[model samples]
Target chain A: MKHLIRKDFLKEGYVFATRAAEIARAAGGHTRPARLASNENPYPPSPKAVKAAADVLPPHANRYPDETNKEFIDALKKRHGDYRFVASVGMDGIIDTVIRTLIADGDQVAVATPTYSYYGLAVQAQGGTTVSVPRKADFSVDPEAFCRDAAGGTKLAFLCTPNNPTGGTTETPETIAAICENYEGILFLDCAYIEFDGTDYRPLMKRYRNLIIGRTMSKAYSLAGLRVGYAFVPEWYEPIYQRAATPPFTLNMVSQAAATAALRDTVHVKKIVSVVQEWRQRFIDECPYPVVPGGANFVMVDVAPP
Target chain B: MSPPRKADDVVTELAQKGGVIVRSCASFPPGLPDHYIRVSIGEPWENEAFIAAITDIYQP
Candidate 1:
C-alpha cells in the first residue's frame, strides 16, 4: 500500500469523534439519546430567533448571504460593546484568515498541549510551526515555563479559557497580560467557553493591542448547527484581519439571525448556564470522580481507580 | 455482594431508562475503576432513578 498521507497529515491520527459516532449509531436501536459529550446546548434557540430566521430566509433566499455579514457584526458589537473590530466566519475560514493575516511562513505559534488539537493543525497548515509547552501535571500551562519558552520564532500565543477537555481556565489576568508583554507576536485568546465560565473578558480586551478573542455561537447559544463564530481583534490589527477575511457579510443567513436573536435573550442564556452549573455542582458533590468546576457549560470529570 | 457489570455496563443501563443518561469517563486512558460512573444531575425523578441503580452496586 502506498503511504499516501501528506507529511504534515502524518502526525494526525486518532479521530476519536469518528469512532464514537460509529459506536453510537450502531448502538442506536435503544431509545433516549442524551449526548453530553459535545458540550452543545441541550435546548433549542429562542422563539424570537426562530421567527427572525423564518422572516428573513424566504425573502433573502434568492441572494447569497451578505458578504460583510453586517447584521451579525452589528449585533455582536451591540452585545460586545464594539463592532468596529469583530470578525465572523466559520471556524476553519476564520482560523485561516487570522493565521494568514498575522503569521509569516515559519513564524512560531506557542500554545499549551493536551490542549485543543485544531490550533496547532491550523498553524501547521499555514506553514507555521507549533511550539508546544506541555501542560503541567495538573493540565495547565506553567506561566513561568511558557514565558521562558516564548522566545525565538514565537510570534503567536494561543490560550483557551476554561480550556477544552481539561475544563479549567487561566487563573489570573496578570499571567496572560505578562505573556502578551513578553512576546511580540499576536496573542489569540480563544474564550469560546467564556460564557460557560461565567466570566467576561470585555475589560481585558483593552489591555493589549495584540490580543484577539475567538468565540463561537455553538456552545452556549444553542446554535452550533448555524456555524456562526466571531473574533474580537485589537483595533490596530483590524485592517489586517479585514483584508485577510472573506467579503464583509459572510455569515450564514439563518445563523446570523439566530445569533442576533440569541444575543437579546440574555435571560435564556442565564437560565441555561445556571441549570448546567447547578447540575455540574450536584454531580461533583455526589460522584466519587474529580470535577474541575468553572463558568463554562461543561465540566470535565475524571474517574480514577481506587 | 455481587458487583455490577463494568462501568460501561452501567452506562448502558442508565441509557436504557428514558431521559436518563450519564457519561462513562472510563473511555479515557487509565479507565475508571470497576465501578466508577460519571452521571449528570437531572430532574428529581431522573436523579433519584440514577441513585437507586447506582447504590444497588455499592460495596459498602
Candidate 2:
C-alpha cells in the first residue's frame, strides 16, 4: 500500500521545529524563549490593521470571499501601479500558482542558487525539474551565465532580489536588461524584500513584458500570520493564468480586509522599514565578523573558522 | 581550543544543554562549513543573553 504513494512525496520528510514554547516548558516553565530563526518581523501588525480584520470577523463568516480581491488589488494598484494582479494566501501560494501555470510535467525551470528552498520544493511537487545556476564565489549571480544556461528548454527563470539567506541583491536593472535581452522565458522575479532596499522596479515592468513580480504582506507589512500576497503579472500572462483555472476565492474575507487596511497605513510601514534599516546598519558596524552587504532587513555574516 | 572532529556536534550540544538556538548553516543548500552558524540578530538584551550563553559554553 505504501508503494502506491508518489515517490517524491515519500522523499520529503517533515522536519520538526525546535519550538521555543516547548523548550521553555521542558526547562520547567522558567521563561519563554525567543524564536528568531524565522525571518519574520519582530513587530506585530498595526492596531488599525488588527481592528480592520476584527471588524470583518463578525457577520462575514457566512459569506464567500471576494475572489477577485478587487479592493486589495485596487489598493496595490493605486500604490504600485495598474498591473494585472492576483492575490493568494502567501508568496508560497503565489509561487505554486505561477509554477503550475507555466510549468508542465518534466519541464525545466532555471533558478540561481543558493536562493530560497521553496522554489525547488514547489518545482519538484509539480513534477518539473530545477536547473540551478550556482552563484559566484562572492555570492553574486552571473546574469550572462544564467542567460546562456536558460537557453536550453527552460520554461521559466526565477530570480530573487535581495536574495534570502545571503542578503545580496542578485539582479540589478542593467543585469535584468541583459537577461531579458538574452533569455527567452518567463521571468518570475520574487521581490519579497523590495521595500527594505527601497528601490522600485515597477518602471522596468513596463519595458519587460516577460516579467512577473511577486510581493508579499508577510515581511514589511507585518502580516505574516495573515498569509496574504499578490503578484503583478504582465497583461499577456493574465489570459494564460485565467485559463489555468486557479482556485477561486484564494484569499478569504478577513485577510483581504486586513491586507487592504495594512496597505492604507503607509506610515506604519515606513516606520518599520526605517527601524529595520537602522538596526541593519548597527549590526554591520558593531558585529565582530565580516558581514555581507545586506540590502534586506536581515544580515548574513561570515562566521567561518577563525 | 576546539576539537578536531565535526564542529556541528558542539553546536548541537550547546542547543541541547545551554538552550541557545542558532541555525547550523549545514541546513541550507551548499551546506556551509561545519563551523558556520547562522545567528538571527535580535533585540539588545535578547542578543546579550545569546552571547552570554555562547560565551559560557565555549570560553569556559
Candidate 3:
C-alpha cells in the first residue's frame, strides 16, 4: 500500500502554514488568535464581490461553472489589457499547472532561494530537479546567477516579486528583462503581492514572449477563501497552456462571480492595499528587530539578538 | 540583549503563549537564518498585540 504512493510524495509531504484556529488551540483554547502567519488580508472582500457571489451561488448551485471562464477573463482583460488568460484554483494551482506543462522527468527548474517554497516542491513532485541559486544577503536576486542557473538546461524558472517569506521583490524590472533576454527557458513572474507594491511589470509581458505573469484575488482583494488565480500568458503559449494546463471548469461559478466583481471594484482593492501598506510600514518602523525592507503585506524580521 | 532563540522555538512560544501566529523562516531554504521570522501585517490592534507579545517574550 505504501508503494502505491509516489516516492517523492512519500519523501516530502506538503506543509501548510499554521491556521488561526490552530494557534488558538495551541494557546490553551483561547479564542481570537492574531493570525499573522499566512499573508491573508485581515479584512473581508468587497461588499460588491460578496453580493455578486451570493447572488449567483443560490441560482447556480445546480449548474457546473462555465468552462470557458469568459466573464472572469473578460473582466481581467478589461483591467489587464488583452492577453491570453488562464484562471485556476489559486496561484499555487497555476504554478503546479505550469510546472506540469513544462517539466518532464529529470528536467530542471530554476528558482532563487528564500523565496516561495512551493516552486521547489512542485518541481520535485513532477520528478524534476530544482536548481536553486541563493539570494544575496539582503534577499535580493542576482540576475547573472539566476540566468546562469536557468541556462543550464532548465525548462522553466519561477520568480516571485514581493516574494513570500522574505516579502521583498527579488529582482528589478531591468534584471528581469536581462534574464528574459539571456535565458531560453520559460520565466514565470509571480506577482501575487504586486497590488501591495503597486508595480505594474505587465508591460514586460509585451516585450518577452517567454514570460508569464501570475496574479491572484487572494491578497488585496480579500478573496483568499474563494481561491481565484489567473495569469497573463504569452500569445504563443496560450494554446499550449489551454491544452496542457487548463482543465475544464477549474473555477467554480461562485468564485468566478466573486473574482470578476472584485476585479471590477478597483476601489475596494485599493482600500485594502492602502491599509495593508500602511500597517506593513508601521510594522517595519516599530519592530524592535532589524526588519527586512519589503513592499509586500508582511515583514521579515531578523530576530537574532544583537 | 537576550541570546537568540531558534526560529521554531520563537514561533511555538508566540503561538502557544501569546496566541499570535507568525512564520519561522527556518523552512525557507539556503541562507535564511534560523532566528528570522516572517510576520504578516494585521489590523492596528492586532499588530499592537503582536508587538507587545514578541517584545515581552524577546526581552533581555
Candidate 4:
C-alpha cells in the first residue's frame, strides 16, 4: 500500500465543545437543548443587520462574491485607520491565513498554554512546531517565559487575551510590547473577545509593526453564523499576505452586507455587551462554586467533583 | 454509602436521569482532571435545573 497522507494529520484529533443536542439525542431524551457549549452571543443580530442580509440574499446569490471585498475592507479601514486589513470567513480562517502567510515547514510558533487550542492546532496543520509556554497559575502569560521560547527558528507567536475557557485575566500591553521587542518573529494577538475585555490594542499596533491584531464579529456582535472576521496587518505585510493568500471572495455578499450593517449599529452591540457583562458578574456572584473572574461574555465556573 | 463518583458518571447520570446536559472537562488537554465539568451560564430556570440535578446526584 502506498504511504500517502501526512502521518501527523492522522495522529491529530478534532476535540471541540460537544453540542448538548448531540448528547441529548444519544441519551434519547426529549428535552429542548439549551446551547451553551460554544461561546456564542446569546442574542440574535440587530434588526438592521437582519434587514441588510435579507436585502442582499436574493439578487446576489447567483454571482461570485466580490473578490476584492472593497466595501467591507473600506469600512474596516475607517474603523482601524491607516492599518491594512483582511476580512475573511471567520476568525479561525483569519488565523489560518496568517499561519499560511508566515510559517514554512519546521518554523516555530510560540503559544501560551490553556489559551485557544486552535492556534497551536493550526500551526501544526501547516507543518510548524508549536512551542507551548505555560501561563501563570492564574492563566496570565509570563512574558519572559514566552519570549524565552521565542528564541531561534520561532517565526510566529500567538497571545489570546482574556483567553477562552479561562475567561479571566489578560496580557498587559507592556507585556505584549515586551514579547514583540524580544522575539524577532511575528506576533499574532487574537482579540476575538476584545469587546468583552475592553482593551484597545490599536495603539500598541502603531508601536510594533510585527504585531497583527485579529478580531471577529462572532462574539460580541451576535454574528457568528455570518462568519465575518477581519485582521489589522502591518502595511508592509499586507501585499505579502495578499500574495501568499487565496483570492479575496472568501466572504459571500450577504455576509459582507450584514457585517457592514452590524459595524454601523454600535448601539446594538453596546446593549448586548452591557447585558452580557452584567450577567457574567451576576453569575459569578450567585454561583456556589468558585468561578474565575471573567472579563469576557462567559464566566468559567468550576464544578465540584462528584 | 457509595464512594464519590467521577465527572463522567455525573455527566452521564445528569443526562440520562435528569434530562440535563453539561460538559465534561476531562478531554480539555494538556491534561485537566476528571473532577471538573464546565456549565455554560444560561437563563435562570435552566441554571436552576442544572443545580437541581447536581444537588440530587451529590446529595444522594
DockQ of each: 0.18, 0.31, 0.69, 0.38
Number of the top TM-score candidate: 3
lDDT of 2 by residue, A1-306 (tens): 989987768776433235433554475533545444466777777888899999998979899988778899899988887678878899888898889997878999998777677888788888899998777766677888988877789989888887776776546777777787788998888888878887677776788888888899998899989999888888888867755636766888889999999999999999888877877777667655456766776666555433
Angstrom error at residue B1, model 2: 6.9
- Clashing residue pairs in candidate 3, if any? none
Question: After best superposition, candidate 2 residue A118: deviation in angstroms?
Answer: 0.9
Instruction: Name model 3 segments beyond 4 Å from true.
Output: A19-24
Give the poorly placed runs of model 4, Cα more than 4 Å off.
Answer: A28-30, B1-21, B31-34, B39-60
lDDT of each: 0.65, 0.74, 0.84, 0.76
Q: Among all windows of ten consecutive residues in candidate 3 chain A, which has the lowest summed lDDT?
A: A12-21
lDDT of 2 by residue, B2-57 (tens): 34324355445445555655554455565344454445555555455555555555
- All predictions: root-mean-square deviation over Cα? 4.5, 2.9, 1.6, 2.7
- Candidate number with the higher TM-score (1 or 4): 4
**TM-score of predicted chain B, candidate 4:** 0.81
Per-model interface RMSD values are: 5.5, 3.9, 1.8, 3.3
Q: Model 2, stretches more than 4 Å misplaced?
A: A13-30, B1-20, B31-35, B41-44, B47-60
Native contacts recovered, each model: 0.10, 0.14, 0.72, 0.27
In every candidate, how many clashes are there? 13, 0, 0, 0
TM-score of every candidate's chain A: 0.89, 0.93, 0.96, 0.94
For residues A1-306, what per-residue lDDT tens digits would candidate 3 score against the true structure? Answer: 998988888775555676434756956855778888888899989999999999998877998889878999999899988778999999988898899889979999988777888898889888999887777777778888888766769889888888888876546788889888998999999989888998777888889988999999999899999999999999988787777765666889999999999999999888888888888887877777778888888999887775
